[model samples]
Target: MFKQLIPIALIAVCTPALAAEPMVVQVKRLSLDTALKIAQGSIAACREKGIQIGVTVVDRDGTVQVTLRDTIAAPITVPISEQKARTAVNFNAATSAMKDRANSPIGRIDGLVMSAGGVPILVGGSALAGGVGVSGAPAGETDEECALAGVAKVQEDLDLAM
Candidate 1:
C-alpha cells in the first residue's frame, strides 16, 4: 500500500513538469499611433530637403501599418516605399546594408527591394519593432537617412519601454 501511494504521489508531482509549455507567447507589436508618428517623421525629414517623398511603416511581420505620400510625390513611390519597408523587415537589416544583394537571387524575390531606402526600427537595442521605408529622394542614401530620422523620432520611447 505504501509503495502504491509513493508511485501515485510521484506521478502527481511530475505531471506538472511533464505538461506542455504554453502554446502561445507574448510578442511586442507596433501601435498605430507610433506607426503614424514614424511615417510623419520620415516625410518631414524629406520635406526639409525639398524632396517630395512617400513613406511606409511596416510591422515586424512585414505588414504595412501606415503609408504617407506627399502630394507631389510620384505615384510610383507608394509601392516602392512599401516594398522597401517589407524588404527591411524580411531581412531584419537596413536595405543599405543589403545593396550588394540587389542583383542576387535573394533580391529577385518579389517584394524584396534590396535598396538603401529601408531601415529597421529596433527596440531596446535588440528587439525588432518594425521598419521604415522612404522613396522619391534623389538618392537611396537620402531616403535611408529620412527613414532613420523617422525611427529616431520614437527611439527614446522604444528604449524606455524596454
Candidate 2:
C-alpha cells in the first residue's frame, strides 16, 4: 500500500507542473555575414602593414563562423587564428590578456592558448557575441590591432543588426 501511495503522490505532484506554461529564453548569436566581414577587415588591416595573415571569427559558443587566409600566410596560421578566437570567447576578454588569468588553476586548463591576437566581440551590457583572432602578424600587438580593425569595420553593422 505504501509503495502504491508513493507512486500516486509523485504523479499528483508532477501532473500539475506539466500543465504550467513553459518559459522561453532568447539567446543572442553571431551571423555568418558579419563574421566574413570581420575576417576581411582584419586581413586588410594586416595587408596595410605588408603582412600576410590569417583571420578567424567564432560565434559565442566558440564555433568557427568564418576564416580567411592571405595568399602568403602559412597553413599553420589557420588553426592558430581559430584557437585564438575560441580562447577569447572562452575567456570573455582579449586573448592577449589571458596570461594574467592563466595564473589560476582553472585558467591553466588544457586546450586553451593564453596567447595574443584574440579579441572578444561584445554587445550590449558587455555580453559576448563572438570573437575575432588574427595570426601571422609580426607581433602580438599588431595582430590585436588587426582584430580591432575587424571589429571597427563592422561596428555599425553590428549595432544596427542588434
Candidate 3:
C-alpha cells in the first residue's frame, strides 16, 4: 500500500509540471487578390521593358499563390518562375543575393532555384509574407527588377498592415 501511495504521490507531484499551456499562434498570410496584383504588376513592369516574362508569387509556406505568363513568354519560364519563388520564400532572402550558393550543395535541393529573379515579400520591411519570382527576361537582374516592381505595387498596403 505504501509503495502504491508513493507512486501516486509522485504522479500527483509531476502532473502539474506536465500540464502545458494551450498553444495558439497567429500568422499573417497573403491573400489571392494581393497575389494577383503582384503577378500583374511584375508582368506590366517587364512589358514596359519589352520583355515578356513569367511571374510567380508564393506564400510563406512556399506554396504557389499566383503564376502569370506574358503572351509571348516561353513555356519553360513558368516552372522556373515557380522554383525561384519557392527558393526565395524557403531561404527568406532574394535569390540574387544567394549567387554564391548556386553551385553549392544546398542549391542542389529539389524545387529550389538560386537564380537572381526571386525576391522575398516582406510586411513592414521585416515580417516575411511571401516571395515573387520573374523569369524569361534577357538577364536575371532584369527579372529581379520586375519582381521588385511587383512587390513595390503593394508596399504601402503591407506597411500599413503592420
Best by lDDT: 3
> Per-prediction TM-score, please?
0.87, 0.80, 0.87
Tens-digit lDDT string for candidate 2 (1-162)? 998899899999998888785677577887778888889999999999999999999999989999999999998889889988999998899988777776778667775667789999987538789999889987988999999999989887677766
Model 1 earns a TM-score of 0.87
- RMSD values, in order shown: 3.9, 3.6, 2.8
Q: State the local distance difference test value for candidate 1.
A: 0.93
Worst 10 residues of 3 by lDDT: 16-25
Compute the lDDT for candidate 3: 0.94
lDDT of the structure predicted as candidate 2: 0.87
Report the lDDT tens digits of candidate 3 across residue range 30-145. 99999999999999999999999999999999899999999989999999999999999988999999989988999889888998999999998889999999999989999999
Name every residue pair that clashes in candidate 1: none
Which ranges of candidate 3 are over 4 A from the true structure? 1-22
What is the lDDT ranking, best to worst?
3, 1, 2
The lDDT values for all models are 0.93, 0.87, 0.94
Q: Is candidate 1 or candidate 3 better by lDDT?
A: 3
